[model samples]
Target: MDYLIKTGCRKIVHFAAAQHLLIGKNRQNGYLHALYKNGIPVDDNLIFKCDNYNEAAHLTEKLIRSGNTPDAIFAVNDMTALGALSTIKSIGLKVPEDISIIGFTNGLISTMSDPPLSTIEQHGYEMGQIAVRLLLNRLSKDDDGYTPEIRVLKTDLVLRGTTKTLKEDKLGRGLLY
Candidate 1:
């Protein structure tokens, strides 16, 4: 979440499934922290909690109609992001031009969306390789107590057409700013 915000994402609309998982909660907290660190006031109304893809699509349509469009949407996963993309397009809004959408897990659906989605690549294979190496090291160690080391795998951002390089136009920009 911090990384996404650091990349210049402003308002973030999170999409989640029916049963929220611990990971989802953690991500939401991270988003909140990013907003706080950047001095952006968090608006609870901006957070739309949906049950599934269908619900998310409905909520997204409502949001766009109500004029509560966000600069970017961070879906809990790629499936939801794809749904949001469909809804946005169904309403005749140009993706990336009107709003930017991002998803996690870099799932297949992300790439298949109308405008391929941008996602966080969770290198599971790399983590598995590192785990195997660690296990081998542990097994080969002599009969002596050893401190267990932890490795945090870094994530990569896979850019795509779902997001715009520039921030969306701010409301009242011409008159206010």
Candidate 2:
């Protein structure tokens, strides 16, 4: 995204996981939004739709072999990132050295990787808490005219071994340290 460009990455590949799904579509939109907001031109070629780890890995390999290797990769999820990392390694490349990688959803497996993955943490616990509260509120309200309220939970970026810090000037407020 903007950070990747500011960090001197001219080419960034996005591995989308099932764009038909709500989460997938939203993530893709966010990625495009970041690029547009940063004044980066959209490149359809760099966007690859992948459903799982295997598809991601296969695409990564193909991209490399075709001399279309990206300077950075943004995966839809930790599993996709892991698969891309495996392909990158198989091609004799180093993580955060030759290319940087980032994933969404800071799942447990992310921390256990060889070079721990840098990921965005979705506050699942807080979300569940909010959901329960909403349910209680709904149950407590006997009025049939009650309207649903929408709430947006924030996410945090957990920096780890997969990425390096960009220059201070390139840093944005969106990243939660």
Candidate 3:
């Protein structure tokens, strides 16, 4: 969300997950925080509980038909983002030109898209390894003295062809400040 804001995107459409899931709530909260920090007002109509490919495609097509094309789109996952990308192109819009897109979960599909997708890499492999190690440690414990541990992993922003960055300098030149 911050990436989109920093890139000068004010009207961002978010493809969110269900509110009941903790991960979804966390992501939505982060999205709201980023918008607020960047001084961008939240447009209630721009958000949708869309986390899958079919729903994303349908909603995107509807938005396009309504002539409410967003400046950028932030989807819950790569598949959902891909669906939007396909719809946007089908409607004759160009990625990173008419609109920008970013997705969570940098899966293989992200790189396979036409222009490729910009996404957040959650380091799933590392997460799985950490989980296995944690489980083994707990299992090998002789007593209940071994306390559970929580490991935090950092996510990386992998930029690709489907998005653009517009960094404004102090002098308003194209150079990033």
Candidate 4:
């Protein structure tokens, strides 16, 4: 989210899941931090909380119809992002040009999206492989004292046409509503 803000994104609409999971909470927190850091006052009313993709798409469509289109939408996951994309297009607006959409979890759906969604790559498979390796090491270790290992995977921000280039916005400050 900070990255988005720094890259000239304004008015972030997050599509959170109904269940309050750690991932969802963290993503929301990141949005808040970015808004705060950018000196943009947070607007609680702007946050659209939804249960699933279907609900998110419906709510997003409503917002668009109400003339409350956000500059960028940060979905909790790829599925939700896809839902928003569908709604945005259905409303006769072009992606990135009208509203930039970003999502977490660089799943296949993200890449399959029309413009190819920009997302945060979680690298779940690599993480799982590392976890299995660690477990096997622990299990096969001899009497020699063993120490647990910790591994942190890196996340990359994938660039795609779903977002606009910085030069696209003449005014450095992004659109806010």
lDDT for each residue of candidate 1 in 9-126, tens digit (9 for 90 to 100): 6777877543357666766776677789888889888776763678778888989899988777888777777778889999998877777888778977777887999888878789
- The reply for model 2, stretches above 4 Å from the true place, is 135-149, 167-177
lDDT of 3 by residue, 5-100 (tens): 777789999999999997788778888889998888998999999999899999999998998989999998899999999999998999988889
Q: For residues 1-177, write the lDDT of model 4, one tens digit per residue.
A: 765675666788877754377666767887788888889889886776764689779989888889888888888888888888999998899988878888888988788879999888989899889999998989898758678776767888887878875543575665432
Please tell me which predicted candidate would have the highest TM-score against the true structure.
3
- Two-way TM-score contest, 1 vs 4, winner: 4
Q: Supply candidate 3's per-residue lDDT for 72.
A: 94
Q: Give the candidates in order of TM-score, highest first.
A: 3, 2, 4, 1
Colliding pairs, model 2: none
lDDT of 2: 0.83
lDDT of 2 at 20: 74
Which ranking of candidates, highest lDDT first?
Answer: 3, 2, 4, 1
Tens-digit lDDT track of model 2 for 1-177:
555666667688898868778788888998899888877788999998975689889999999999998888989999999999889998999888788888888989999987999888988889899999999999888789667987877878787887767534364433322
> Which one wins by lDDT: 2 or 3?
3
Q: For candidate 1, give the lDDT.
A: 0.75
User: TM-scores of the models, in the given order?
Assistant: 0.72, 0.84, 0.87, 0.78
